[model samples]
Target chain A: MNNTATYHKAIKAATSKLTDIRKFVAKHAREHGFNEKQISDIQLAVDEACTNIIKHAYQFDQTKNFRIELEFDGDQLSITLTDHGSGFDPNRYQRPDLKKQIEKKKRGGMGIFLIKNLMDDVSYSSNNNTNVLRMSKIRS
Target chain B: MKTFKIEHRNSDGFEIIDLYGELDAHTASQLEESLKNLISDQKSNIIVNFRELDYIASAGLGVFMAYIEDVRTIGGDIKLSNMNDKVYNVFDLLGFPTLYDIFDDEKQAIKKFLSDS
Candidate 1:
């Protein structure tokens, strides 16, 4: 059966929107028969992605907005987040050294780390107008 | 939108903050403020009770990371307890098990703080 489908939402680049974003993902993932653990993983990965965009790309500019697109099929789910401000550089991200972060009082790098760990595959790309972070998870 | 709340319970020498509802980037600041106040007040033997927290994002974890060292240096600790499997899984994925002390029960965490002091 061809069960492929797509969903999208455009949200303001503010911390307040994070709850709505998670709800949107959970509502659809449950409808698509994703298990609790799978839904949690996707929700967290997407949350981390959007949080990074709001903080880094738009710098908490509520006037700016971003888009989240999810497309899923029989055995996989994929999410793409697009922002219009300064895009993130994936190469600049080092694996967060937890002890050092604590010692140095750092708190920024863990979001990307969590996104990578929660999603099965993740990649990034950006143009003059758009920066995109794409992540995918396989249903187990 | 789901609401996030923090309720403080005073123990003999430390304090336990019970969290309710979802904790994400939006609600993380509230937790950050609570931790900050506790540290400034020198009430640092902190036990965060996650029994009612249905969800947590990396941002929530970041709040903990930002403050854990401060509390430890003040001769106290921010021990966590009663995390749901989902929340615990996130922490475990980030290798938090080795860095922070986690307890299956709130009493255990309290006991740990008391024993250390």
Candidate 2:
């Protein structure tokens, strides 16, 4: 994976940056051995993560921006989505247990759960005013 | 990415389209265009089958939202049936259960619409 991207403060956390990054991944993921199902799953995972950023990252001001990056080496893909607005404890984020929620028809927190299920690896870390979320999947 | 294949059948004042595959950002535009063309031809009372559909996204839901008002205003309706969990979750998230009539099968959806008419 190679690194690339520029960050700018633009319209809160809602920007086309995330979608562009996802499309970038989708395009490159195809070059690897990712099938349609795998691509769609990865797309959805990226979408959910972006949605979360827009919803929870910053204050409701339209003068902020977030950073998103995507990289792929022929065998695997990695995405690093970061927000400078705020940072939260990843350990405190409890994903909804599907087995328990299925019987109750519950909603909410499905984003992280789906992302975790689809991606082979997920990690979160905060450094110098940036909350970075990294997700990846290997072609198998 | 998802592709939609449609099968149309003419009934009394109704036209049913059996849709297959995912309805997401990559494919929602196709479905939207197809629906627009059919509507322009005055074919209404549409029922979309999701038996083979695996998923949908916000963009796909937006397409239905765009057409719902037009179809209903013209005294026609659009119904959905046989949605799997992944696809259904998208609809449920957008509050589709209150906006449109959804059923477990095509027959039930057709009958429900016909009876109302």
Candidate 3:
């Protein structure tokens, strides 16, 4: 039998809400049997995803909200973040050139890159003005 | 407990900024402000000690990217040191090791600053 445990919350898409999001993910990840490092990785990936949604999609509009769902199916754990806003085309993403970024004093456009690096699998989709970022990792 | 905090100290002419707790989108601006204040004051020889930093997101890393060039242009540098493995991994993953100098200990970063001058 594949017993699945899930946790979900609709959090405000604001920077101040990031701490609460991390805490929420850590608790659920721990209950899902993720080790310390795995939990940390998932937490960071989720944070990056939400940060991007708040900054890029919602444009720091705290009145808007986003939903975060964490689910564990057997040894696979998946975290989904959904935002209802105008979405950007992921195909246009450029690998951040750190040197040029520093020279130009650019501060953003690194969240998606970090999310991809921290999660085992990462994907993005948008439907009907709702954008979703799904990140998954196998419990080892 | 606070999610993030910044403390500043001076050692041998190097300004040491101590990072504490989790650093994310909400907290990154505070660190940015600290950096801005230091640079505006012309105290450019900076060393960020991440020994106590429990967490960091891309927003946190972006603060460094935003300021490194300005700091260096003013004839000074920002060296990072004392990062735990997890925190270090984020920087490593982003290729920060190439453009930035990361030291195992705070003293090493300070030493580099002294040597450059």
Candidate 4:
């Protein structure tokens, strides 16, 4: 079985909605014997995707709206967060090499790196001024 | 998600805590407060299980770091285990691996605490 959720991206607007999404997915998955660890992983991915949209997508403008979609399969969970903001090529953004960056204690760009590492798959794309970040994890 | 429920269990000179729900800007302070109270009460050697935690931010990580020095001063330590990759990645990015004892499971974390203590 599978389930899905869609939220409009607005600063702090959809923040509370995360709980609903987590419960919705967790409840369904639990019936099929998904463990607590697997459930937490899905919730974390959703939270990260939503937070990214809130923090980066509409950096300064609150008037704009974005969309986040989460879909879950029996063994895999996927979340696609879409933002229509100043589109930057993710390809140009370099991941800060930890061993090197830690010496200076610089922050930023950690979000992307964290999201990528947590999820089994992660990809970024910009089309028609919309930045879509897709993240997925397979339940083990 | 559900609000965090803290379960404190005492096992052989160690405190095992299960932290549930999301750990973000709004909820990070709660962790700090709980830890502060525990420290004031002189209950040290804490282990946090992130088995049910959904996410964490730098500010949330700040909560853990905030108490490390204080806990260490009292000859105690704070350890974490069972972090989903997403949460683990956040900790890894913050370089927590170098500063704290992080493990893949609760057993390992508990063992590390006992063996080191």
Q: Which predicted model would earn the best TM-score? A: 3
Which stretches of model 1 miss by more than 4 angstroms? none
Clashing pairs in 1: none
Residues A15-59, candidate 1, lDDT per residue (tens digit)? 888888888998888877888898998898888888889998999
**lDDT string, candidate 4, B37-107, tens digits:** 88998988888889998667654675776677778789888899999887897787657798788998988
Error of 1 at B80 (Å): 0.7
Arranged by lDDT with the best first, the candidates are 3, 1, 2, 4
Of 3 and 4, the candidate ranking higher by TM-score: 3
DockQ of each: 0.82, 0.08, 0.89, 0.15
Looking at model 2, give its docking quality level. Answer: incorrect
At residue B27, give the lDDT of candidate 3.
91
Error of 1 at A91 (Å): 3.5
Clashes of each: 0, 0, 0, 1
Instruction: Give the CA lDDT, 0 to 100, for residue A69 in model 2.
Output: 66
Q: Compute the interface RMSD for candidate 3.
A: 0.8
As a whole number from 0 to 100, the lDDT of residue B39 in candidate 2 is: 84
Candidate 1 chain A weakest ten by summed lDDT: A87-96
Question: Candidate 2 on B36-106: residue-level lDDT in tens?
Answer: 98789877789888888766555566677677766877888889899987678656654568768899988
Top-DockQ candidate index: 3
Q: Per-residue lDDT tens digits of candidate 3, residues B1-117?
A: 345889999998889999999999889999999999999999999999999998889899999999998899999999999999999999998889999999999999978887788
Q: What C-alpha RMSD separates each model from the true structure? A: 1.5, 8.5, 1.5, 6.3
Better of 1 and 2 by TM-score: 1
* lDDT by residue (tens digit), candidate 4, A1-140: 33443333333424445555556556655654568777665655566565556556666344656665656665666667778776654455566554444334344555555566557898888888878887777767
